[model samples]
Target: MNLALLHDSDFIDHDRVRLTGRRFAHLAGILKVELGDQIPVGQVNGDIGVGRLERLDNDSAELRVTLDTPPPAPLALSLVLAMPRPKMFRRVLQTVSALGVKDIWVINAYKVEKSFWQTPWLADEALSENLSLGLEQARDTLMPQVHLRKRFKPFVEDELPALLQARPGIVAHPGTSTPCPSHINRPATLCIGPEGGFTAYEVDKLVAAGCQAVHLGSRILRVETAVPVLIGRLYDSCAN
Candidate 1:
């Protein structure tokens, strides 16, 4: 973890926090921190700053913290993605968060297996843990929101149009004629499909819902790879 993410529960007082569990293990074991040392810390959805270690033991540690700097600006992008395989979903979630995608929609596609949604990683606790790992990696504190829509048609017909009203929508398909736009650096919602890509009927629905179909050249990238590439391509926020 690059920055120790602080939760409200971690605080004992306005300026003090107690660390335990994975965080304590990392600091006490991996970082091998000494008393009086300072470490980077950020409060969730709050500011970034440093914590000075005042006490330490095998089970826990205490830090006096000061938060002044705000976290990095979030990307002006909304990601609409087909649910990925269980094995890959965790990594994809972290990557999306690290890139500063604050809005995410995980919808079902024709190729997406129903079993994918049954994964424990979708549990609330697991989602928070993975997102926290991503935030810590990026030294960011803002948590990304994940919206799950199991039925594709209803989501496209009902909710997508409203989301598109504020941000233009783009669907990434493998053979589409239009290349994915680069450096738009504006608010947009991007849809990506499962491993085999969205079926013709599914693509039509998304297109009808006001999404422009675009491609990332001839190469087909896995959802995990495409997410970061697409975000980097579309947002100077990520690059900067």
Candidate 2:
């Protein structure tokens, strides 16, 4: 992890922050942080800053923290993804977080297995742990908010309109008249499908909901690869 993140509860005393549990072992062993060393630090949902290691023991380490700037602005896009298999789900979460997406919706698809939803990783704490690892790796403090939708039609037909008010919407499909734009300046809500991709009926629903169908290219990409590539293209477009 590039930045050591702490929760408000983790603080032990003024000018001294204690690391216990997994974080302690991560610092002492994985990171090999030394006393008097200044390490990157941030409070969860707060500012990014530097922490000076003041003391260390077998159980914990203390740090003197200096709060600095707030975390970077979140990506300008929100994602609506069809939930993948459990194994792919973990990677997708991390990938999106690393790319700085702070809003995500994982919805059920026709192709989605019921068993996939039963995975322990769907639990709030487990999801948070995976997302936190991504944020920590990226040196970011803000955690993405993730939501799950079990019904496709109700979500697209009812809730999507309100969500689109803040941004333009696009749905990635395998074949579309318009290719995915290289860049986009405004905030966007991007919907991507499962491995088999969205059914024509599903794509039509999203289109009717104000999402324009677009394609990455002729080539089909797995959910994991498509997410970051699309995000990067959007980011680059905005930059130009």
Candidate 3:
């Protein structure tokens, strides 16, 4: 863990706080933190801070936290992705968060297997754990918000407009008139389809809803590869 993440409950009544659970093990074993060492720390939705290691025991460690600055602003893009297989899901979540994406919508698609929706990783606790790992790796304090859409049509036709407000929207398809733009400064909502890609009908619906169809390249990419590639390119473009 690059950053030590804490919850409100993790703080003691006093300024002292104890690190237990997974975090304690990580610091002790993985990071091998020593007393007087200052570690990057943050609350789930709170400020970024430094934790001065004051004490350590077999099961827990105590620290003095000095919260100072807020975390940097989140990425300007939100991702709409068709749910991938369970094994790929964890990596995708981590990659997106590490890239600073703060909002995600995982939706059903024609090529998506129905059993994918049954994955236990979709549960809140599991999802949070995966996302937290990414945040810690990136030294980011804020957790991304995740939304699941079981029905595709209503989400695209009805709910997507509000999210699209003030943001450019693109639907990633294999073949389209326009290639996906390299870097975008303004906030954008990007939709990526399933393995075989979105059905023509789905594409039509999305296009009608004000989403422009764009392609990454002629060759198809797995969701995991495509997501980070697209996000990184967009981030670089925005930065330049």
Worst 10 residues of 1 by lDDT: 231-240
List candidate 1 stretches off by more than 4 Å: none
Of the pair 1 and 3, which is ahead by lDDT?
1
lDDT by residue (43-84, candidate 1, tens digit) is 999999999999998799999999999999998888999999
Give Cα-based local distance difference scores for all models: 0.94, 0.87, 0.89
- Which pairs of residues clash in candidate 1, taking residues 3 or more apart in a chain or in different chains? none
137-222: candidate 3 lDDT, tens digit per residue: 88888899999999999999889988899778899999797988876767999999988899999999888888999988788899
Q: Give the local distance difference test score of model 2.
A: 0.87
Candidate 3 worst ten-residue window by lDDT? 231-240
Estimated TM-score per prediction? Answer: 0.98, 0.95, 0.95
Question: How far is 37's C-alpha from truth in model 2 (Å)?
Answer: 1.2
- Residue 55 C-alpha lDDT in model 2: 91
Error of 1 at 165 (Å): 1.0
User: Model 3 off-target regions past 4 Å?
Assistant: 237-240
- In TM-score terms, candidate 1 sits at 0.98
Q: How would the candidate models be sorted by lDDT, starting from the highest?
A: 1, 3, 2
